[model samples]
Target: MALGKVKELVSSNPVVIFSNKFCPYCVCVKQLFVLKLGVQYKAIELDQESDGSEIQSALAEWTGQHTLPNVFVGGYHIGDCDSKFDLTP
Candidate 1:
């Protein structure tokens, strides 16, 4: 189910942010995309979902990295928050 949700998010949104509401890094990542880059994005708050852990597990399996703010842009895996900074000036 989590995998399905992940796929749906990736396929539907140009920018998908799988985040935890309480996470600082997650908040930062969202700001980078929405505020700095001016790209409209979809953010799924994993911490609010009952199957958030399951989704995180599936993301780890899919991306081979278990970190919050798992970001995907244009259906491409864009790594974590640190990687996002690397894309910026």
Candidate 2:
């Protein structure tokens, strides 16, 4: 997409995870990556109205599934928290 938009997303520390603020799986993912793994990330809660409509639209366009906890790392789609990280276990 646009470089400016991408820059906006990655403006966080290490990564950015788009979440729903309700899903337990999403919480687990963040805890694992940030608290446990010691990685820093700015999480976006989609269920909240704080973010603008453009961000919601952009998220739908990128992931194609309007589900909670859609993730992004370095501005790249990494799927949801559980599926993105643990495929074997």
Candidate 3:
């Protein structure tokens, strides 16, 4: 739900999930953040077929390129699951 389909509600909490309409990996990513880690966050879904979306813009701002399942914490883009593994340290 990008391109105004959803508006990001800013918060002091860092962890977040960049999701899409039908992605199992994204769902798992969100689960790990919420269920496993018990972290709350802002979930932004990208509209992949609508030419582009705000998610892409955010990706351009926070990261160098647009990618799905992008996660952030502590105001830093820590990437996906692999990056999250680094966060544990």
Candidate 4:
């Protein structure tokens, strides 16, 4: 179910960020996309969700990444904070 939800979100949004509100890395990623690049994105605050744990677990299974700021772009998993920065100039 959680995997299905993740898939639905990834497919529907051009950019999706699975994040935690308090994580600094998550904040950085959000700022880089929304502020630095001025790109619109859907941010799913996992810590604020009722099934946050389940969603995180599903994200790990799907992406092989067990970290905050899991990012997706145009239906492709873009990895974590460091990975996102690596793609940027």
Candidate 5:
């Protein structure tokens, strides 16, 4: 179920970020995409959602990444902040 939801979100959005509100890395990733790159993205703040843990678990299983700020671009997993920075610009 959570995996299905993750797939739907990734397919629907040009960019999707699974984040935690208080994580500095999440904040940085969002700012880089939304502010620096001027790209629009759907940010799912796990700490604020009821099914956040399940969603995160699904994300981990799907991406093999167990970290906040899990990013996807154009339906492709873009990985963490460093990965994003390396790919961008």
Candidate 6:
């Protein structure tokens, strides 16, 4: 299932971002990782993918929350843009 894939991504990568490219909040999260933290992350832009909605839905089911820029770090669901910013070093 798509949710399984979402979990796999979260577990496998140090940082994972499930986002929508057009969303400013999503953009902010990406910038935080790439610009501020200078870390490479796996950014899955749902808006750009054909099965994005399904993936987003699956992410919600798995993580118990739904929003743009769902962020996972070190296999932990760290939450959205603001949460990601909080984790920035």
- Model 3 per-residue lDDT tens digits across residues 1-89: 44233224323446656678577877888888789988887776765545346556756565664666777676566776445346553
* Model 1 weakest 10-residue run by lDDT: 80-89
Rank by lDDT, highest first: 4, 5, 1, 6, 2, 3
Ranking by TM-score: 4, 5, 1, 6, 2, 3
> lDDT per prediction?
0.88, 0.66, 0.63, 0.93, 0.92, 0.87
In Å, residue 13's CA in model 4 sits off its true spot by 0.3
If both were scored by lDDT, which would come out higher, candidate 2 or candidate 5?
A: 5
Q: What is the C-alpha RMSD of each candidate to the true structure, in Å?
A: 2.9, 4.5, 4.6, 2.7, 2.4, 2.8
Tell me model 2's lDDT, rounded to 2 decimals.
Answer: 0.66
Question: Relative to the unseen true structure, what is the Cα RMSD of model 4?
Answer: 2.7
lDDT agreement of model 6 with the native: 0.87
Candidate 6, poorest ten consecutive residues by summed lDDT: 80-89
Best by lDDT: 4
**Per-residue alpha-carbon lDDT of candidate 6 for residues 1-89, written as tens digits (9 for 90 to 100):** 88888988888999999999989999888998999999999999999988899999998898777888898888878898555345554
Writing each residue's lDDT as its tens digit, candidate 4 over 1-89 gives 99999999999999999999999999999999988999999999999999999999999999999998999988888899666334442
Alpha carbon lDDT of residue 45, candidate 4? 99
Best-matching candidate per TM-score: 4
Which tens-of-lDDT digit does each residue in 1-89 have in candidate 5?
A: 99999999999999999999989999998999878999999999999999999999999999999998999888888899666344543
TM-score of each: 0.88, 0.66, 0.63, 0.92, 0.91, 0.88
Q: What C-alpha lDDT does candidate 5 achieve relative to the native structure?
A: 0.92
For the record, the alpha-carbon RMSD of candidate 6 to the native fold, in angstroms, is 2.8
